[model samples]
Target chain A: MKLSDFFRKKSSGSVAKDRLKLVLVSDRTNCSPDIMEQIKNDIIAVISKYLEIDTDELDIKITQTEVDGTTEAVPALFANIPIKNLKVH
Target chain B: MGEVIVVTSGKGGVGKTTTTANVGTGLAKLNKKVVLIDTDIGLRNLDVVMGLENRIVYNLVDVVEGNCRIKQALIKDKRYPNLYLLPSAQTKDKSSVTPEQMKKLADDLRDEFDYILMDCPAGIEQGFRNAIAGADSALVVTTPEVSAVRDADRIIGLLEANEMRRTHLIVNRLRADMVKRGDMMSSDDVVEILAVDLIGVVPDDENVVISTNQGEPLVGNDTLAGQAYMNICRRILGESVPLLDLNGKKGLFERLAEIFRKN
Candidate 1:
């Protein structure tokens, strides 16, 4: 018998719980992993139109965590956009 | 005393029919007058799962078509004295039954039964709309898998848009062994994503197949899965019961020690 077969099995509760979270996150955000990457690129491009930024330092991510009994997903964008020391036209 | 419940899942093969059979049987075992209506039309299997296929002389189509009375279409269950089944028509498609027809039928049955459970066909189409039209509540059945959870989320959205008063989750066919090995999704993960009140978490048991094949529901005093079904039934009757803790991963040494102690 396999090593795993010897152990008392864990319940299906955890697996079902985790799968629903990942799917619901994707469903609510309407952003797949690939789409999220594209959205990050778009944000960088839009920000660069106003100021020069360190593109390599830019970060865009969607994080989900449960607080109490409720789960929440937060979308965050961080960028170090540098403005040139010049008077506005 | 009567409540209309729609058993729905946006994806196929998530055990919607099985849930309907077991829950209906469970409710009936509690002496609640329950009627299970198979709304799958041409793809009907509630009759087969409930072991009432051979007794299905009249179907939902006959009742809707006015060819037969609703009383004639309802097949009484031999196992449960208070349970009845309205089998779906094998010859007709889903389009044959209108939402209005279903609503009228549900209204009429509500006066006679304590619970009316509709076995909705899979997909977010006309069949789903028809199933939920008369339902006061819904139970979304899903497995602890990515695809099934995604579909379940979509179904929840649809149910909300329809202004369904109460919607609960029934996570079905969960394999405890696979979950512990990180090969399957967990119930907590599913509940987090769906963000709905959970009705029950049924473990994947081979006995389910055996019981279904034998045309016997898993709510009787025989197997663990049957006990789980009975627990769900009690919850439906307004009783608070703790879920079974099946997540223990004891080692072989522990099992051997326990066996030795028993000896």
Candidate 2:
């Protein structure tokens, strides 16, 4: 089995696979990957001015979600920020 | 009521016309009355692929523009028990037809046939718009290449936007050997990227070329591409058909020929 596997060509290097992975995800989200990164950064910058967020532990994701009693699902963006301290007004 | 389905591919030359001919012919062979409308207008080719080219006396433009009755332009195919072709006008351009006219035509055809297959022209232009105007379902054909799948993705989005939710994918001209060697995209990759139900995967068979050259559809029981198309037609009727093996597995002929070698 190992010999046959070695003789077989690897499937990961096909250019189509990588390009499709990025493009399809971007398409489903209705935003390009670069735009997504820019949005994430702008969000972090705006929120960080008031509270100290754990930048290393921050998580941002765009996912598909089904709301209550809905016939179809909708795209939802979720962001998790670990707050270390809040600014005193 | 008949279902109007448009066979579309955003990129050209990915076997849209061939699929329309085979699926329509295959359905007809199943004793269902099927009508194939060439919506490509001046770039008509479904008639040739179905071997009904020379018989076209009237075309789609004639039917739409009131030059001829709908029945007067419908070319009946004797090869199949219940098949017909409504060829497109070779002189009139795509602008000659309108979406409203196509919708009205679809309504008129609903009561007359079991399946209405529209052969859509390539590109997301006026031709594509007019082809899809009357369709409630779609079959987007794509090759296993990046460009083809990308274009197919766009077409699927457009189909969904138009509320043609019953969309399926047909991956055409896939070379199984190349796929195994990791040189070409596999069927799974295409279905994953396109995110649609796969209706069929047509193996890259030389018979497709030969049949096209002869102005005939490849539907022989023993031929690989032909058998694949027959399977597609069966699935269109809501039957569960297993996909044909185009990979390294020995086919029936190869296994049977082994007996002769041993003898």
Candidate 3:
């Protein structure tokens, strides 16, 4: 088989894997895509209570990656919270 | 020891009853005394699938209500001598039966049979609770579809909450052609999300429909789906069998080759 054919096959496999991951993550967590989006917004709001953070810089995502032939969904909430400058008295 | 297994699915039409019928038949074929119980009260289908609907003179409610003995309610399968069925009551609702009753019924059959398979009703309601009440282990059935998998996840959570630790998964109604064409979910994809040990994988076979309609299980000889059920039966018996990929093109090619050889 040509290299392009090999890459095409791999890409097809990747697409199926990606779809499975997306569906499975939603199923496993019992959180629909809409719910996940709402959760992200909620997290952003909660973080804003203690720290001034950029909402645009927030990276809240549910992702599934394969490691050692096992697929795992890692739900991570990423944010850049600014530290307040305090003067020592 | 009679192992009480509850075959459950959170979503409907994922083949829970079909799995129970075939697997029960499969085990019976191996000379294991099996008792298949239909817990889907008010919507019972196991009797029809097992071809024992006509033989149901007394049902689970009759036994539970003390109107009849358990032995009188248990219908023996004509095809398999060792296999018996405890058909559900069509007129009664799920509330008519309690978890304690189910557990006691299973306990009564424990010493008589090697396997007690419960055909659980769909949803996480009273029916689901009554089905899983006496189960020593649970077999969660799901199709290779998004909705089915989601329901399976929820069922697993419920099973865990009930403290039923021995849980296995069965992914049914998989279409190999669609999986190959990237139109369906593969077995690996399902297992990854469910995070449970898979017991079996059954392909979408027209024979399943034919047998079900005929009120006969597909666990007879000459059916691909039958062979799959046989494998699942062996696995349930604690045999170390490799998981067969029903969606694998290579396996399909081999099955076709077998047909050609026979011809």
Candidate 4:
């Protein structure tokens, strides 16, 4: 019950739980770490053909999202890429 | 009208057979006509667990292939009233039956029994598909480990994909002492990851291992695991039975360790 331990972000149980959460999301969506990395590289290559994007700051993740008013949360793929410059068409 | 429930866990050796044997026997103990079907095929063992292995004459594969009638395949429990065991064939593999046949068999079983419990094979393969094809509901069993929990999560997802009516969870072989030491996943921790309705929590007990080894039916007893299965049966019957107070502090060794740590 130490105060320092209370604020510690990486308690053993929580650490395992967090890792499992990340893993289950990928499992349920049929996406793995390797697959996601490949996907990120592909998406970056396709998007960079037209625009100079900040690939370093780009983020791609699968998150739980509620659609409309449903009770059950479904996994939604989210990809946010910051654009540095856009080539004029 | 009866309920066909598939007792399944994605990973192997997470007490699926034990849960099926105990819950079916528990329901029969409550005076409900229950038939337990072992769908594991070649690796069948629910009959062994329920002590009905020696009595199985014609099994599931025989019944499905029309070599024998369904009634002939069902071995009545000599001890438990109104409980029956429809054993699987040891000679046949999982593909000996198909999901369509299982669905038909489940429909036929619903006409005569009050409850039909299917002991599903482990893994999400053809055996697993055949097992779940019949049941309207599911009970995902898991141990308190990361791998077991993850497998259970996938099972829940599969159940949802199949549009099963309901999916409940049973956390098995939980070591309360490890959870208290913050070294293992507790029941609450399991529920959080799986995101399913909680049916029961079976504390790790030597009684289970001993009974399993002896091929004896685990009826009501003072053991925590027995009580947990009883509670699960009650819940299945729509009764609001509370879970065991598995606080993890009552065991003598746990108490001694806590005292030493405090000193």
Instruction: Report DockQ per prediction, comma-separated.
Output: 0.34, 0.38, 0.25, 0.49
Candidates 2 and 3 compared: the better one by lDDT is 2
Worst 10 residues of 2 chain B by lDDT: B213-222
Q: Estimate each model's TM-score.
A: 0.81, 0.79, 0.81, 0.84
- Per-residue lDDT tens digits for candidate 4, residues B1-263, read 99999999999999999999999999999999999999998997998898887887999999999998999889988887799999989998998999999999999999899999999999999999999998989999999888899999888888998999999999999887778777778889889778788999998888898999988756577677888889999999999988887763476987899899999
RMSD of 4: 5.0
CAPRI classification of candidate 1: acceptable
lDDT of each residue in A19-60, candidate 1, tens digit only: 455556667767788997898788867866766666666666
Q: Could you tell me how far off, in angstroms, the CA of residue B173 lies in candidate 2 after the best superposition? A: 1.0
Alpha-carbon shift of residue B220 in model 3 (angstroms): 3.9
Q: How much is the lDDT of residue B125 in candidate 4?
A: 93
**How should the candidates be ordered by DockQ, best one leading?**
4, 2, 1, 3
Model 2 local distance difference test score:
0.88
* Quality class of the docking in candidate 2, CAPRI style: acceptable
Q: Best by DockQ, which number?
A: 4
> Across residues B1-263, which tens digit of lDDT does each residue of candidate 2 receive?
99999999999999999999989988998889999999998998998888888899999999999999999999999887789999999998999999889989987999999999999999998899899999989999999988889889999998888888699999999898888777888999898767799999999888888888887787646788999999999999999999998863677998889888999
Ranking by lDDT: 4, 2, 3, 1
Lowest-sum lDDT 10-residue window in model 1 chain A: A78-87
- Where does model 4 exceed 4 Å of error? A1-11, A32-35, A46-89, B248-263
Superposed model 2: Cα runs more than 4 Å off: A1-13, A28-89, B248-263
User: Under CAPRI classification, how is model 3 graded?
Assistant: acceptable
